[model samples]
Target: MRTVAGTGVAAVVFAGTLVTGSCQASEATGFGRLHPEADFLGSSVPVSERAGAVGRRTASVSAVAPDGLPGLDVSHYQKTVDWPGVAARGAKFAYMKATESTTYLDPTFATNYAGSANAGLVRGAYHFGLPDQASGAAQAEFFVANGGGWVNDGKTLPPVLDIEYNPYSTADWAGWCYNRTPAEVTAWLTDFVTTVDDRTGRWPVIYTTRGWWNHCTGGDVTVPAHSPLWISPVASDAGGPPGMPAGWSAYTFYQWAKSGTFPGDQDVFAGTAADLAAFAAGPAS
Candidate 1:
C-alpha cells in the first residue's frame, strides 16, 4: 500500500502493483471529487460575480467573444454532454479531459471523444497534470497510452497538457506549485512536453492561467516558444485573455467562459476555420 502525503488517502493494490487511491477512485468511478481545468483559475465562478474575488484584470466580453471558431472543453464534471446539440449550436472544436496523473482516466472520455466526432466536431484530448505525484515522463506516457495521443487526420487537434495549480493543496499536501521549487517545476514541465512531442511527433498545446504560470513556472519563457498557448482568463461580461504569459506573444486558444452557449467551458480558436483545420493537420514539415 502507498499513501499520498497529506492527502489522508492510501492506495490499495491487489496484484502488488495495481494502485487505487481516493482521488483516482473518484476520477475513475465518477464518485467523490477531483479538480477540473477551471477550478484553480476561478473560472468556475462567473466573471461578473467574481470581480472582487478574482482580484485580477478581466477582459471585455467583446474583445474576447467568439470572433474565431467557437469551441468547448469538457470533463466528467460536465457529465453526459449533448455533442450533437453542441455542434448544431456552432461549436467547431472540443477538448476533453482524457487522463489525470498516472493513475486516473476520465471515465467519460471515450464516450465524449467518440460522441463529439460523430457530431462532426473536431476534437482533442487534454491531460490534467499532477506534477507532485509522479515523474512528468510517467504521466505523459500514461496519458498517451490512454487517450492523449494525436493524429494528423485534419480533425484531431494536437494533444494538450493542462498544467495548472495543485488542486490537492490542503492541510495535508503542499501548496500551489506542488511544493516544488520553480526550477523543479520547470524541469518537470520540460520532461512532460518533451516526452509527448517525441511520442506524438507534434508539440502538445499547453493550457494554463497567467497567475499560475507566473507563480509556478517563474514565468518561464522557453516552453512557450515550442508549445502553443491555451490561455484561460476569467470571462467577463465585457476585453481579451489576460496578458500573454512569459514568451508567448499571442494565445492559440482562449477558454473564455466556464459555462455559456456551449455545455462546458466556452472557448475560441485564434483563427478561422481553415486555420483551425491547418492546425489540426499539424505544423508544416
Candidate 2:
C-alpha cells in the first residue's frame, strides 16, 4: 500500500489504498477537495453564467439529434449506483472515474467498472488529471496501474483523460488553468495522451469543455489525431451540438447534462449502437 503524507490529519485508508489524508478529510467536510468525477465544469462556473458568452450556442436539443445513444458517467459521489436501473432507463454506455493524479484511486472504481459491465453496458474508465501536481506520464502510469487500462473487447471503450478546470482552485490560489502557462499546459497534456496511447495501444479519449480548452491551451496544442473527443457542453446552453476544440472535427461522446434520465452526468454516443460497439472493439485488427 502506498502512503502519502496527510497534511494535519491522520491518514485514512479506503479500499486498501492510503491517499493523502487531507483529501478524505476535505471531502468529508465538503470543502477544499475535488470529488472523483464530480461536475467540475458546472460547479466552477454555472452554465447559466456562460449563456451570453461568445461562441455559446442557444439552439434547442431537438436540433442536435434524433438523440444519439444515451450514456452516463459516475464516480464515488453516486455511491451504490443502480446500474441495472440505469440500463433499463436506456443508458447504453458508461464511464467511471478510476484514478486521479499519481495517487488517489476512486474507492468505487472496481465496483462501478464491474457492475456496469455486468449490467451489459459498454463501460470504460477515466482519469481526472492534476497536471500541476505531477508529470502527465506519471499520472497516466498511475491511472493504468490502478483501473484505467483499456481492452478492445467490444465491452470496453478507450480510457479517457478527463482534463478540465482545476476543482481545487480557490480565492488565494491561481484560478482556472491550474497555474500553468498555456504552453506548459499543452505540453503536459501531450505527454499524458502520448503515454496512455503508448501503454494501451489505443488512443485515450480526451474530455474537456470548449472554453477551458481554449483558455488553458491558448487554442493551440495538437492532440493525438486518433484520440476521440468527449466534449462536455451544458445541454441547455448548447445551441445545437457543442463546438469542437481545435484538432477535432466531431465529438465521439457528448456529456450534455450533469443529471437527467440516468445517474451522474448524462451523455450520448455520436453514432449508432453498432458504431459504439465498433469503437469499443478498437481499430480492426
Candidate 3:
C-alpha cells in the first residue's frame, strides 16, 4: 500500500503536512509491522461488557452512511470500480480513500471520485489519518486540496477522517505505533476535525474502531456532537449495535466486514436513503 516511498528528507508544510511527502528521517525505510484496526482496537473489552463474539474480540462500533443503507469505502485495493456497475448492484453511497499520511495519495482517488459521482451515488472522500506522520490540520488540508473537500451538495457525503493503526507499524517496517498520551492524540484529532470543518463548512465524519480510540484518547475524548461517528468492527458474528464513542449515542456508519464485497469495503448505514440525502445536504444548504 505504501507506494512513492523513500528514506530521509525534509519537505514543505502547508497546513502542517509535507507537500512533497519527502522522506522522513524518523521513519526508517526498512521498518516494522503495522497492525490493522482489529489488532489495535476492541481487544480490551470484557465479554459481559462487549458485543458479538466475546472472548477478546473487537469492541462495539459506531458509524455513518445512514443506518441500514448499504454502502462501502474503496481504496486502490479495490481497483477501478464500475461506478455504474456498483450503483446498479445496489450500493446507495460510497466513501473513497483519498489520501494517507502527508505523502501517500491513493492512485484511484480521481477515477473513483468521478465514477461515484457519475453513478448518482452519494459519495465523499476520506483521509487515512497518520497521526505520527504530520499534523492533523496539515493532513486534512492536503486531503481537501486533493479533492476530499465537502460541500452542501446533496449528492455528496461529508468528508471522513479514517483514524486507526497503520499497517506498517510492525517492528519490521516503520515500526510505527502511536505512543502519544490520550490527551495528545485527542488534541490532534480535535485539531483535525476543526481544520476540516474550517475548510468544508461542516465537521467531517470520524472513522475508527473503539479499541484504537480508547488506546489513543484514553477512551474518553469528547468528539463534537456535530461530528458523526463511523465505527469499524470486523466480526463475522457481529450482531449488536457497535460500541458508541465517548460522547455519541449512535453511530452514523458502520463497517463490519473487511472482505466479502466486490470493488470496495462493505459497510452499513443506520438510516434510509432519504436520511442519507438529508445528512449530506447539510444544514440550510
TM-score of 2: 0.81
What are the per-residue Cα lDDT tens digits for candidate 1 across 28-142?
A: 4322354443332233222432312333333334444656789989887777999999999999999988777766656567788889999999999998887887789988988
lDDT score for candidate 3 against the true structure: 0.65
Instruction: In model 2, state the lDDT of residue 165.
Output: 67
Q: Residues 228-285, candidate 2, lDDT per residue (tens digit)?
A: 8888774444567776778788889887766678877778899999999989988732
lDDT of 1 at 199: 90
Q: Estimate each model's TM-score.
A: 0.80, 0.81, 0.75
Q: Is candidate 1 or candidate 3 better by lDDT?
A: 1
lDDT of each: 0.73, 0.72, 0.65
Which regions in candidate 3 have their CA more than 4 angstroms from the true location? 1-67, 170-177
Residue-level lDDT for 97 in candidate 2: 80
**Candidates sorted by lDDT, descending order?**
1, 2, 3
